[model samples]
Target: MIEAYQKLWPNRASVKNIRTQQELEQQILIELNDELTHPRVRKSKEEKLALAFSRIEQSDLTKQQKKDLVSLYKKIAAQ
Candidate 1:
């Protein structure tokens, strides 16, 4: 990776820093790509995840589904 970075940089010699402008830009692009792969977050999605247990709290036969839902909601909330 370092070798490739040096090859892409025209002023490799003067660039004493480990990460050049191009390398930094590439890193940002990689991170953006990763974030973009996830579906865009929406207000409704947040609202729904926020109310994870509200409806189910009073419902019966929700034990197993609640475990799955809480786990799923936590995962979404984290992102």
Candidate 2:
């Protein structure tokens, strides 16, 4: 019973504390905001994506078309 409990409740040394999706997103948002505000840093990944999306939105493309274009643009930018 004690061994089973030990196995179920893993030690901190054995278990990694991974951030949840929400936590990761918040962290990324903080980093992006910092980069956006930094004068020297200029456009970060978030900024570039946002600018691209904005440009696509301004174009004459339909809603779905713009979304598809933006998705492709993000994928390429991620590379």
Most accurate candidate by TM-score:
2
- The digit string of per-residue lDDT tens for model 2 on 1-79 reads 2222123224633222324544433433443344436678676777766865666677666676666655655555555
- What are the C-alpha RMSDs, in order, of all predicted structures? 17.8, 16.2
Give the TM-score (vs. native) of candidate 2. 0.40
Location of the lowest summed lDDT over 10 successive residues in candidate 1: 1-10
Model 2: residues with Cα > 4 Å off, grouped in runs: 1-42
Q: What number of backbone clashes does candidate 2 have, counting pairs of residues 3 or more apart or in separate chains?
A: 0
Q: Residues 5-74, candidate 1: write the lDDT tens digits.
A: 3333336453335465455444423332334344565234445444434544544434665565455445
- Rate residue 43 of model 2 by lDDT: 69
lDDT values, one for every candidate: 0.44, 0.49
Query: Would you estimate the TM-scores of all the predictions?
Result: 0.33, 0.40
Query: In model 1, which runs have C-alpha deviations exceeding 4 angstroms?
Result: 1-48
